[model samples]
Target chain A: MKTVYVCSNTVTGIYSAIYDAWKARKGEEECSVALRGAVETELFCEYVEVEETVHKAQAVEALICRHLGREAYWDIYHAVLAADTGKGDAILGAMLAAKTIPDSRRIMEHLSHPKVEKVFELSRSVIGEAHFLKGAVRFRELAGGVLYARISPKAQVLTCLAPHFADRLPLENWMIYDRVHRMFVIHEAKKRWILVQDEFLDPERLPDLTEEEKEYTKLWKGFVHAVSVESRENLKLQRQHLPLRFRPDMVEYM
Target chain B: MSSSESMTTYTYEGIPQYMPQGAGGLRPSMFQKLNILADAAKYDVACTSSGTARSNDGTGMGSCERSGICHSYSADGRCISLLKILFTNECIYDCKYCINRRSNDVIRTSFTPDEVCTLTIEFYRRNYIEGLFLSSGILRSPDYTMELIYAAIYKLRKEYNFQGYIHVKAIPGASKELIQKVGFLADRMSVNLELPTAESLKLLAPHKTRKNILTPMRLVQNRMAENKQELALYRNAPGFVPAGQSTQMIIGATPETDFQIMQVAQSLYQRFELKRVFYSAFIHVNEDSLLPARTDEGPPLLREHRLYQADWLLRYYHFRAEELLSEENPNFNVLFDPKCNWALKHLGQFPVEINRADYKMLLRVPGLGYKSAVRIVKARRVGTLDFSDLKKIGVVLKRAMYFITCNGKMLYPTKLEEDYIARNLLSAGEKLPGEVVNMGYHQLSLFDDVGFSGKMQQYM
Candidate 1:
């Protein structure tokens, strides 16, 4: 009978489930990982609930980094952060397939393997969305002078974008709220950034815009309008590059 | 006349004293100046913010990314990477095609150096722009305008500690000293090659000489060479135009052949080592005898797009200008892109074996991008890749299938004839330009006229 390890849908929970499956010495065909809420009941399968912990997650991270190498570890980390519920199984399969390969560090380059390919695809998409959000994330100055931005990215990209913004704006107090994940990346002036989860922001109690913010918004809108060539107006091409989904958060479109 | 009567009445004037008030005297607000200056600067097409990657030293407020970032797109579908605006619209030159020609009656305004700094910092902090793209009209002289640009960028870099990307225009006739000073503060510097040939420059822009423009370009090239050596000797020598220089020419303005324009661009890339060469389709901004006649047809955007396609071929695909175009075939085909057109003409090179072909040959395939070509080489090292693997590797098989062979077998039993492949490729849902799609297939000729297409009038 196949064994299924159930865990919450998160980086830590998935890694802990992987640790439990690995500790039981289960082969690729003998074990599978499933998310807690997205689990499907299977007949002739022994289901086990994983006791998630920070230590288990750290052990799994270190084990992958030590055996699969840093680059493959990076890919697996990004795959875990992806929105796909089957990412835990794909990651575990790739790890198990790595042991059969001549060099475990070259697992990512083994694109012919099904599980490795799935991990590669998921990592690429998560990285792609994070790269786009690095540019598309727009900040608005509130009345208190804190730079606040809101993004609704599919992946858990708050961790990926927080360091970039913190390094880019070191002296400014800034916070980015991921509306989809209900997570916040808060950074104080000249301080390290911290991630806060399970937080809710009331839309009605949003901060008021500063005077300078309104003035700059008007100037930016006018500039965006005037910079476009009158003879070569192509809204279709604009929509192709910047999709309508990202237009609501962008100030120029607003 | 009594002195008291003259002072009180002030009615003894043949021409009244020039009173510069209202629009001329009162300074335009920040909003008005940004609109006027950005509007005047819209004719310039280079808005790229790539080629420089720097991190904030924890002292400055901004950083640069290697691939660059597009904060937004304008209505014309161009990427808004930088806050592209002119320092001033005041000019002493009367170029025929310029909207801000000294003869044209348009509202002119200039921004102070401090205003430029404030706008850059505020916009960058809000993630509204990647950086500042500062160009200017000759306010009084080339050197004078260059000094103003230098002052603004210097203030932005030093006082404001702005470490973001800065692309500045090197005034054509400006002195070498001023250009060098400005280059040290900017990430990229460019001197506009307004026309492709000297004859066209003489016919259109009387004030600008080709020799005057090339002199600054050659100066920047030599200085960058020297800067490279200095940086090699000393690790922190304060780089000069680290992203290198780029230039733009007004396409369709001077009746230059596509072959001639591309040859010039190829030479610039090879000789001057430019980072990019932007081609602006000639928009009818002014109606002068020297310029093209104003018509209902809009800018020759399709022709411009074809030229850019050929430009990419030259840069990335290791293609030469003579290979893409010749004296006989002076322009690109409206039906096919430059690469596909090249491939169709050279059918003997087709059915390239995916497992045995070299990297350069893989790049010549129609649907194989540089990235996909690289993946094929890497993935083929592990195992023999079949058709399905190529599709998973992101190759557009609908187009590449006709050109490539997997394990000595074509994906489909396809004919090697040129006309057959062309017809099949067209039916495979290749997305052509809007104008080309609207016009029926029969209307396109093998060598279509690149300029003044009658089909473009409908776009108006």
Candidate 2:
């Protein structure tokens, strides 16, 4: 019987499912994994809904980090955050390839393998989205002097962007709210940042920019307008570098 | 030209307080000043926002990271909008290629230090820019202009606590003391080598000489070297141009060949320890007989592209100027890129066995980039890589097919003949950037076509 472990789309959920599937030892052929909410339930197949357990997830994470190395572990970790529903299965495929490949630690570098390539493709896309958000996400100084920025990224990239801002703006109280994921990473001034998932992120509740913030925004608009050469104005090229989707949140475009 | 008396001086008092009337007699608002200064600054192409990794100290608003972030790309596909503006467009020198030459009847403007600081801090806070790339026309004497630049950046760093990457130009003929003072505050600094050679400098920019440019570059390099030593000894010794310095050479404005340009770049890297040598394609903005005719064809952008390709080969690929071009063949083949052209010339190096070749040898193969080569080196250790495996490894089999062998066998039966490979390579459509191809002029004209119409009639 082919056992398909249906898991939640989160990294912890996928790792938990991977742990349970490995414990069953049905090997590569009999057992498979699928991310819940990502795929439709099949009619006749034996489906196992893997429960989320921290211990199980930690064990699987430790095993991958130890056996396949940190690079592959991070690749799988970031790929898991991808919006693709098939990412869970891709991780399973990659883990299987890692077990079988001779130099298992360097399995991620084996791009010729379909399993490894799938993980890289997902990771690249997720990382690429996070990189764009790093440059594109604009913050407004709220009335309380807290920096507030909202990003409606396609990928679940809030966690990925948190470390960058935390490192760069260590003393600033800032919150990077992800609209799609209904999650946020908030860092208090000189304190550690924490990621919280809450569905109460309403645009109407966002405070207006302070008077200083308003002045800066106007000054920025003036500079941006002046900087572009009239003769060499190429909107098509500009669109290619910074796509149209990112512009809606940009202060200059707004 | 080298005399101190020859230098023109424009003091702070010498600058006009308001907008000099032209182009709509509206009172020059701050916005209008920004527009004119920014428009004037656009011709400069070196707007890189990389090199420094200054972290925020909590009090300030920004941080500079190692890899540069491009905020926006211009219509030419060049990165722009980095708060790149001239401190002032008022000039003393009369360089023929310059839009703000002394002879030109353009609107003159200057940004006060306080205004420049506010613009940089504000734009940075909004995430509209990576950092500031501040350049200027010679407002007065080089010393006076350099002093104004120093005053502006001094406020941005010390007053505003703005820690973002700042790339400022070190005005040639500025006193060494002022350049050093500004050097400590800036992340990166540059001196423009307006024209490639001394003779070209003499012909166009009568006031500026080759010495005026090279002197500041050498000064920055020396200061950066000293700063490195001091940094090693004292942890908190403020880094002097921590990102190092770069210089720009205007291409196609002068009659220098690719060979000469590459040699200049090669020597600059070896001698000066410069971070980058920017190549600006000459856009004919002035109506001087000394300048090239401005046809709709625009600048020699294609030639500039080829030179940049060769430059990468020099920096990363371990190739030299002499190897890529000689006096006999000083220009790159317009049909093929530098790498492929080299591969064709040295056909004996072809059919490198994929598994057996070292990392360096693999890099020379057509269609194999540094990343793919590194991947190949890593992947081959696990198992024998076949042709299909090579495809999955991101190797462009289209070009690499002629150059590499898998498992002691060619992917297909192929000849090592140059013309055969060149024909195949040509048919594959060189896969250059679209802008490069769009800027290209046809080498053969339809007007010069003899029997091409006769051949067309056969199809008709």
Task: Compute DockQ for each candidate against the true complex.
Answer: 0.80, 0.51
Per-residue accuracy of model 1 over B77-179 as CA lDDT, tens digit each: 9999999999888788999999998899888777877799999999999998999999999866788778878888988999999999999999999999999
lDDT of 1 at B446: 33
Q: What is the lDDT for B45 in model 1?
A: 93
Candidate 2 DockQ category? Answer: medium
Candidate 1, residue A133: Cα displacement in angstroms equals 1.3
Clashing pairs in 2: A234-B75, B8-B141, B9-B141, B10-B140
For model 2 the local lDDT of residue B336 reads 68
State how far residue B118 of model 2 sits from its true place (Å): 1.6
Clash pairs detected, candidate 1: none
Q: In candidate 1, what are the lDDT values of residues A123-221, reduced to their tens digit? A: 999998888888889899998999999998889999999988998999999999999989999999999999998879886787898999989989999
Candidate 2 segments whose C-alpha is farther than 4 A from its true place? A23-26, A40-44, A53-59, A100-104, A141-146, A209-222, A229-236, B1-27, B432-460
> lDDT winner among the candidates?
1
> Model 2: per-residue lDDT, tens digit, B166-284?
88999999999989999999999999988889999999999998998999999999988888899899999999998888888888877788888999999888899988888977877
